[model samples]
Target: MKKLYFLIFTFSFLGYITEAQQLLRGPYQQKKTPNSMNIRWRTADSLDAKVYYGTDLNNLNLTATVSTLENDHDVELKNLSPYTKYFYKIESGGNVLSGPDTAHWFRTAPVAGTVQPIRVWATGDFGKGNDGQRLTRDAYLNYSKDKETDVWIWLGDNAYQDGADSDYQAKVFEQYYAYGDIFKFMHFYPSPGNHDYNSVCGIPCQQDPRQHKGPYYSIITAPQQGEAGGEPSTLENYYSFDYGNAHFISLNSELGSPTAAYDWIGAYTNGASTSPMIQWLKDDLSKNTQPWVIAYWHQPPYTKGSHDSDLFYEIYMKAIREKITPILEQYGVDLVVNGHSHAFERSYLLKGLTGTAATFNAQTNVVNGTSGKESLGEAYIKYTDGTKPNEGTVYVVCGNSGSDVAANKALFYNGSPHPAMFYWDGGTGVCGSFIIDIDGNKLTGRYLTSNNVVKDEFTIKKQSVTGIKNINSITSSISDAKVFPNPFAKNATLSFTLSKPMALNIELFSTDGKMSRVLSNSSFNEGEHSIEINSDALHLSKGEYIVKINEGKSASFERLFKVD
Candidate 1:
């Protein structure tokens, strides 16, 4: 009787262990577009999958109306809202799994030219199971907690050892879930890496069917021809979209060539330049007047890290120089963000090939000076005079999300072939992320360490648009002005040009039309005089404020901003 009891007890204990091991959660992968977001997870056995979501976390009144999809471990929830947050959960079988029950949240991106900031968390090579990975995850979560992050950009090599689904769950998902609350919110935007392709070599027993797809996909963030909000592709791995004052073009670095991605980008860029998207971006920028045009992909155009500037990938870079970057520059593009290197590095406003020197002449300056509502001219201007022109595109390498083995410390130094503004070895911990604040004409970026420290910081100012007062060339006694850093935090500088010197008065008012402070009351010179306004002294909070600048009765420009 005692022997039989012992056998039963052992069997029951083993069964419980198996069931506990099978529980699925953590490491949510890939959410795209305006309306719908997809959720991919795993379970130990065949079980019913359901997601409970709503605007209110306490009262998740809205559940996935459709029947739960069974058998498959991955599930996608569709028909969501743009720029709205939804709380969700996953259930296995009929039981609401408790361990993985942490509420997952996602915010849809606004349509093109909406003027809202498009926030993304980017990191690369972060699949190793180490302290660095944990630090990266923690920092990402900390930022997400404070900011409204629309998506998480994974530059590649998301899982180490092998890219098998199981390894992804163990190393990537489980390790991520170690901090369940922080990551439950943002959805992942992933790219492929060399290690991800090595599943065949490392995982003998496991065969992932998605290998052929290479985990490559594209997402559009606005309403489109075939779909309502936007859609994700299962076809070719690359696609493009227009989102809130920018045209986002994502490519497949591992599978496709520059030729294919270039053609696709050309069509999209040309269309955006002429289509309603252009007007929207223009209006968005006009209202917000944020000084940044941004783009992201898995590979870096310039890097001093483990992967030297890839000449093969340079073909794509050249294409961008010829087609895409020109358009962005024409539209006053401020930044281009990328990851692939296993460290964080930032570049100066660079132009041309490495080691090229050139001069800045009048014609060159005029050509580069062309701003808002102009066509991005031919490539000759960018690569002319044997030097690369700074059309104000700052390339950044933020691939140090978690995975850092064989990291190159030399890349961080000034003597490197491609010098970066900053670099970090794996010793400091693996994961780190960047936060960008786009307030009016200035774009400020903060690089946070794994422990939530601001490791590096930089700011890019928007170039003042010239020739606005050239309208006076056609009409005498005309009026115009400009205010910068519209979303002024502590202070903002306002500058304007006049046909002739005139006395000017500037009044800053709250959104409710209450006068807050007077920026300038003295008569100023005519060329271009900047007046600084201190916001904090006015005792105002973050919201839209109006700036009315008046020069006698003939000149004025009304601008608005959300103070931070």
Candidate 2:
């Protein structure tokens, strides 16, 4: 296996390098936005790095230079155009290291919050530094067939055993570099896993910010000030970012791990209103205007993979499901993604339940009509109208990118996929990754196997007031919608439709369901729309509030309950 792998590597990389200097790793991308991009690469020697880039391959007019001699090079090119592709070449000490080949290029991220087509490559527990990793990477490459990847997400366990620098060097950095130059062009957002929590001992910079110890702290550089999007998180361990129209969140579930007690960054509980991570999550979700939100971390909230969610791995999973899931659901998060167990587990759209597999009562918790495949006719619809805001969120366990089953293969969790799971067996033993593509209001997740087959595919259609015409509706105008998290705590957002143009009058009713206050009286254009209601400003106490929307004489009424 080692000999065969070495032959594959030699044949693949030997032709790419034509110089004397050894190209160790990277030319990978990070912290990419519409106007700026962080391009990084490493060399065998401390050499001054210069990047010659331009929109046209033939005329490389622009040059971004770093004079300092360094092996690990980072050149951030700013003031560039959005959603535009550019060709680039890396030069070291006056010598060209890599070329003006068409593959050597990057596209600036679409303008933040701008609706555009985006393809995201996702993986977890993939960094084994083995042939399996190579296979997974190759499979995606084959599946892509030259399509551009906007963002890549690593769901922790990026390296094997302990996430030491050497482990990551072989597994992640070198591995991806060997696969292709895509590592050099696409932005990668990652979180830490249990294996990544192994103490770094003497490495001070790698020490976990919250007093934990790990090498993962030193390896990753994520956005610190909403540079990419979402809320500002100075801490690199967890942050949120936006590309195109989807808001991507990377959380540290290792902090919530009970079994991995030594890796605590902080504790988050439903009882605590001011937990650092929890508060940040709420603030991030509350402020985000994006119609799509996709959040991922290391551990899954529900799974029967290598680790059983019913009997073990409960410390973090339970906290996430019971304490965290509600917050996400309240804000109408479209997807919850993670990878702890090493297998592919995609869940049916679920809501409002926390416990073992037995607790997943599809009859009540699952939205029968709210979710299905687009290819099958009905697509999962998340209503942004705030009325019947779809409570269902699909949870995908994508830990099988490079790694497979652990320990005894057939003896775990009764050796069967969880009932709530949609597609579990995708390969010889469920080794694959997920690709998330967002085009306007339509978001689809395709689980691609190592054989280049899309084993599972599903679509999520979001009908937002801001994007009324983007969805399937009878009219080019008005649609009536109500707000969600009905029993309100802080606020509400409603989705409504308008045909042509009309004046809208929204009113509030007291607990007795009597007209109490006029919320808004304004004119609206055609298509779907949404509005926000501030419950606290109304000085409303714990009780019910009735909301009525009147378009001239026609009216729609809904009830809202508030809690402290």
Candidate 3:
């Protein structure tokens, strides 16, 4: 009877062990790096964790790089190659040493500063468990298949309903794993969102211990050097890095008001705009200069979605306007990418309020001759000095990567008045994503829907700085000429700047060396004069067109432009 009792007790103990193992099947978090990747998963009881990785999914070679930590279930796989692909799986030992046996793959980035077009997938507020999210992911996968992007930027709101590990797994991880091969290769750079802070039901909560702390961090890699490439701050929150020709700054939006993170941002922004970082950026631009400077964060400066535009976080917006936007403008930052509102909107070439004032204040001339030549509407300009014309910064609201809980139609209509480039109600089109191509002197941005339709397009040209010339030095007798608005648009207000008053011949030529239109051969004065040239009459395309200002046997200047 004693032996029988002993056997029965052993059986009960084994049953308890099985139940514990079942409870720990999930809750895995992984982060990728240029040379290696790290993964952490939990189990109810202590066990040896191991990972198997190889080039082939069906046959993974067991890694002796095994590490065992007490209660710490994280594993790091290192010594990866740049721009290469590999497969991996995780396993733990129990009563029978069972197998998860599931395989996954990833690719590392190419060497930094390599002369290749770097493509990145960017989106935010995409954690809804619905068709919108699925469509966005599928579109990205298709693009990745075509482009082979180097990195993926998660602008925040990664997992709605509180940034819990389970929510991330169900909404983010599972959805992305649909294209696991592409993801296995690309590094995911993420920032924190308000929803990530567990701020639901108006309750303030402490950080969840299941995942990495605050979620603000940076990473550096090869083809990029020194201070610019790596994550310098806490792995869980706040970091900065440089890639190719751009300096990417990511911030934590859910952290404390006026916390250490704020101070860090000020220091980094100030230093990067001035010293080594700026020099690096300038040098990169001088060589294979990308005309677009981009930065991403979870929350947006402007949004009309679930959050009202008036409900904008004032303090944060103020921080961006004062400390951030100036540095961006000083360094010629052309684009700011964000995700929070769940729809897409693009603004005109804008200077945030501060930059607008500075730019206008620096300008010594203004052309207010015609109504059309007046400042680009009141909404586009913020006259801080109350003297100069308005020059405002552009803000894009692109958040609809997933299903919408509700529609915010008003958000689509309100904009900076230059022209509403593109707007979409969340319920209509397939979720929105954009691709920006910076090649040589021109930058083109394309907005694509889930079905891969090019919904909207725009291009910005590189501005050339010309040296000032003296009017007295020219032998070419200046004549009847006019270039309106001096710095014209679809058409320029033409005027003559002649050395000696004479009859002038004005003609517009396409960049292809083709003459499109002839303005006048009328007689004029030696001083400043004016005339109007209808750019539409020339039928010139949007690019550098030569405007020949010819007088008798003298000279001229080729003024350029946009004909749209």
Candidate 4:
């Protein structure tokens, strides 16, 4: 009888083991650096947490095991290879929960300041858990099928109604799982909006950001220690990161003063704020060496979409415009993206207009007055040289990803679109998202509607020609001269064909016209000739530089982009 009882108990335990723990939240990725990654998930029950990962799906040779048995799993895989693809699977209680399939893989970030093509998908107010949300996601997936998305940026209101954990579970995480494998693959950087703040500090949300804690704070794992680059902010509400040849700043407009009893202006005031966030911003910007700088947050400095920036009650928008924009411009920030308005709106290259929409003067504020469309031969060009300091910044309002914007017309000041906006949806009933593609010195942004139609597109190109004096004076001898890798790392090969044996002088200069290096000062043969430009010998930094090849009477200027 004892043997029979023991056999029955063993069978019961084996049956229980066969049942798997269900995943509740995410298998999402965060804080992705070239050498490290953070993966988090939630299960229905407490169980031993483990992540099996490797470069090959068939052979997951590495295991990151957690000692504690908990429902929430947060695993950090460190000392990883840069720009490598790794396949992984989640396991709990010794049972495989997710997968080691093709869908369960992530590409690590490349070395910072590497000049590589990167694609970013950005959307705002997309946590509705409705058909609109599903369609918008589907459109991005369909459009980006051929290309892998490197980064996903959220423009707040990630969850609808309220920013509760339950709302995020239903509308954000579960919805991504239901729609596609976005959470499983792409890593995201998020900024909180007023709706997200509502769940953190209640309605009319006002609280010390230093002491703030809630679902939004707990769910995200941003880099607060400068591991991914930039000076450490030590605050999750706002931080900075460097990827490839670009720098990204994620700011929080929902934060409030740490000292004040009830003041909600956290990031900055009309001029400067007592808040530390502004100080951190200055420090981060001053330390940034990347050529392309893009900053994003919740409230826009200029918009006429779902929200009116002209209203005095719109304090958040006003503060960003009057207080924050001057600082960004001072640092030569290329782009500022925001989402509080529910319609798509894009501004011309602008600067020095801090007042209301009525105070906007095109003659004084508009930098590049032409439409920034490359096909129209009006692509905005920014020179890194001191010749064009604070050229301009392009502002975008892309908050209609999942939310309806029918009520935007009611808030438009004087029932007219803000004059600052060069392009806007203007209530065409278009629901969509945007994409940013960066390659070398050029960046192109496109707005794609739910139907996968390209509605608006613009391009920004960074060029350097400061030291090229009298470049158009003459032309001779030099033919088919070009840099094999214009945007290169380590070393670059400069090849040219000379019409005759002539003395050549090659020199490199920084964007500010400072001499960087004297590459060649000798005569080349008449036929094809090549010279290797080494980064080590030149001590090159990641930025734009001009190379001048002088042949006595004729000179040729070529731009070179050096990456670390």
Candidate 5:
């Protein structure tokens, strides 16, 4: 009788273990703050979901659990340290589902407004569930390796065709060809595209955002209460977050009024600022204290790729340029990225040109006409002072992540490249994405292709513009300045003319923005003066340096190169 009872009890225990729920989707992360993180996933059975997490991987003593039995699960891990890495795993009915492995960890965002090195990966129109998407994903993974991406932003059209629940599962969550490897790690912040909105509205996709509810809305978590920074947007479609020293705003271009004639124009109207999105944008920008501001959305304001920006029927593109762009420029937005055009396009440092392609006057619109390439010694620079406020913004059309541009897609305007664009694919039929690295005052952007090629790149540096009036005064006093035999082996002559007698000091700074040597410090009488920049004396390395002359409260800088 005792043996029969033991066998029956063992069989019942085994049966209970076999019925453990199976994980269907994400052990993925979403809407992270300094102290909290939202970890979401799906399972096959309706069962209680729990998360085991802690700073130490070997000992996950912390647990966040939800008793509700449902297929989809969202568990929030709270009271975490800021800028910290925590290892985590998901479970259903106490059944271990995912991991406490190496990839199963996330780092909280840095303290708000703090300066730190932040790497961002952005994809657009990539949820095609094909090899194109896989290749692009692989390229980034290969390029970054162990250097994890701090923020992953979706530039919209996240899923192709109908963007239904099934489509998101197959195209984004399930398929290895579409960001399957990425989910276990990086947290994504998304902005809606026209196709993503299709899931909310029906076939033709005329969405009334006031009543916006759909698969896309359900799958993603928007930080609506200023959890990351900025003012609380209160709506999921648009929001802002701060990472390090940069402020990022994710706007909703597809948000149209239920009352407007055309859906696209509601976000950016002709006269009065009726759009709550635009109002929030202005309010957000006014409060931002970060040095760099980067804003992104779906439809681009300037494009000549698969879509033409010059055409009137492209109301979305036109509306953004004419109605919304001025506000961004007004508050000095540094960069704007969009995806919709299925081709890579980058603009010159631009401002104030809100009209058609023909109206792009170089003098009035082009803030800096140079290529803005760091290697070419023409990296764009912005001043911290109020003088250069609202002067320039670099716009990037990064739509071709998965959607390859076909042969018929015109990549030009009026039989030539758009007057605004400085670099574009030029119909090379390549698929690419954008990678941005921000460290302190420098921001570098690269157009990286699927085959791991850097097709285009640019760097922007921010510097303080102090003593500008004094600088001009001193610059005029020193009429002529030259570095003779610049590529000097031993020494070089820095000659300059002084209109009036003054105390002056000559110093040399390395190209990396550090002072290398102080050549001279004395009072010089009015006349032409020359100082020897002796390489051996200063032990200067073979590289470029800036020769700065200080006269009281004023300073002037000139470039000098050293060689073998």
Candidate 6:
């Protein structure tokens, strides 16, 4: 017994000392399924690839070793159980190089059609190689605590200053090495942004015309054979994957289909039906058996920030909105997220009407005219009844993860008041990331910012026929309801009229369901009534708030605008 303890302590002490072997990048995971997944990494000198894994943390008795010598390491672990957790330790040259630690295990995806709670962390244009990127990552880490992500996707531009090998090492690998555990334990997926293909653009870091090749095209290993669960694309630039009961698609908007979108009125707008990527999308969604579908890319289809979607010259955003959106709508995609713009922007649930920003008639395209906050009793509905799919899709721009250069700050607040966008924020340092959680029939997404504030939260849930509520059943006497002088500074007045005498209960609540204060709780006579909401009392930041009025059983909620 004394010998065993001495040997164990000696091995652990040796592990802490003289561990000088450097891992160039990764231990990154990819191509995941219920029974299979691939692990990858890189080293400075050529070495064989090996991964020691098992169900128990102490004993990684199972071995998948490859004797071939190479700098880039890849080992596929197969014949695993569905929804099971496996502990692993990466190795090269017979030395235990990475993990066997606490944060070195991953849970296999649940079988298809199976229901489970899954979390995904998404960031757009985050490969800037700056402190802002680090802060964004740390903020998310603080928010998520020790909870591991099942699916993590990057919105592209993964490396800065040309997508070269050295650039990737400096900007991505070294700066993000602290997050190496995430790569080891979760499937890391990414799409190409314009910067990822910088060589193909004007400010070339490097370029290849021979096969439209760039650094991004060289490094990524996306699914082209439905290995991760989706219709096979047979192409690397675009692909899809499935996790539990949800399907996610990653597309290349920068060079999608027609190659490049021209600024002309209808350049690539009418060509999507003929584009290879679009055709694959149609087929993929048509055969999908999952209850939720999410698609993301580098450029956004709607924005007024650093990039303008309404501008005729920015044809990528326009063409995608006018072209690809209709197909997604036709098949019922729940969410579309992208990066490119330099701030956070989320749209109201919208359907149809995809002409231009000016053409987005709110009265027609905007569904559920309310603010889409479930706490305020407003949310878009999607029925999983197999017969009805009436919910509208929500678009989000999470482009604030880019570099924090002065020029980047200027790029962020370029424009505002995009008619189609319901929520947008951009300032010198207003940066954040988004979290999407799916548990059974409920899907909730919240925007977590650099300051650790969840500024926006929304939920899209599925309901059965029996769970549906009749909107007409509720009755209230509030009419000509208005909040003035539009956006009040200190005190805002809520005015409404009642046809008959009724009991009234007016209160203020934050968007996150925190009941702030009660404005009134007394019976009121007929005619007009006005109540003042003191901003100092409610104690909210400069944004929007929910003002609720309860008359007997029926309730009407209004969005109160507060300004600094």
lDDT winner between candidates 1 and 2? 2
Cα deviation of 475 in candidate 3 (Å)? 20
Model 6 TM: 0.75
Model 4 regions more than 4 Å off: 1-21, 176-180, 203-206, 257-272, 407-415, 426-429, 466-564
Between candidates 2 and 3, the TM-score winner? 2
lDDT of 1 by residue, 1-564 (tens): 999999999998886777556666542534455676665555667766666667776766655533454443445557777777777666666544432333466666665456665565666777776777787777666666766665455566667765776656566666443333445666654555546656432211122222443322222121233132222333233334444554443443443222322233222224223333223334433333322346566656566565555444344333333444444455545666766676677654444422211232222222222111112211111211111122445667776676543533534443454533333433334457666655444456667778788766666544322212311111133233445554355876766666676676777765344456777787666576667766667666654454556555333434434333
Tens digit of per-residue lDDT, candidate 2, span 1-564: 999999999976764564534677777777787888877777888989888999999999999999999888888888899888988888887778777778788888777788778888889988787766777788988888778888888898888878887887777877443333557565688888878866443211233345654567655667878988889977887899888888988987766422222223223333334356777899999999888899999888777777777765266677677667788888888888898888887776777767777776655456432225675544665656543555568889888888888545522345566767766753335578899988988889998887778888888876543312233322234455655655456887767777678887887766343337778898888777887878778777655455667665345555455555
What is candidate 4's local distance difference test score? 0.79
What CA RMSD would candidate 1 show?
A: 11.3
Number of the top candidate by lDDT?
Answer: 5
**In terms of TM-score, which candidate is strongest?**
5
TM-score, predicted candidate 3 vs. hidden true structure: 0.64
What's the CA RMSD for each of the models? Answer: 11.3, 12.1, 9.4, 12.2, 7.5, 9.5
TM-score of each: 0.59, 0.74, 0.64, 0.78, 0.80, 0.75
> Alpha-carbon error at 325 in model 2, in Å?
1.6
lDDT of 5 at 1: 97
Q: By descending TM-score, how would the candidates be arranged?
A: 5, 4, 6, 2, 3, 1
lDDT of each residue in 389-431, candidate 4, tens digit only: 4478998888878876775363453458788777887353557
Clash count for candidate 3 is 34
lDDT over C-alpha atoms for residue 501 of model 2: 80
Q: List the residue pairs that clash in candidate 6.
A: none
Per-residue error (Å), model 4, residue 97: 0.6
lDDT of 5 by residue, 1-564 (tens): 999999999998776556433777888899988888999998888989899988899999999999999988989888888999999988887788888798899999888888889999989988888877888888998899999799889999999976788889888996478865568889999998889888786433455556789889899987889998988999897999988788999987776543453343453344225667778888999999988999999899998888888887776778788777899998889999999988889998889988898898875677666677878766776655432444689999998888876655665633667889989873434688999999988999999999999989998888754323433333667766767674466888988999999998888877566546788899999999999878888988765566778886666665555655
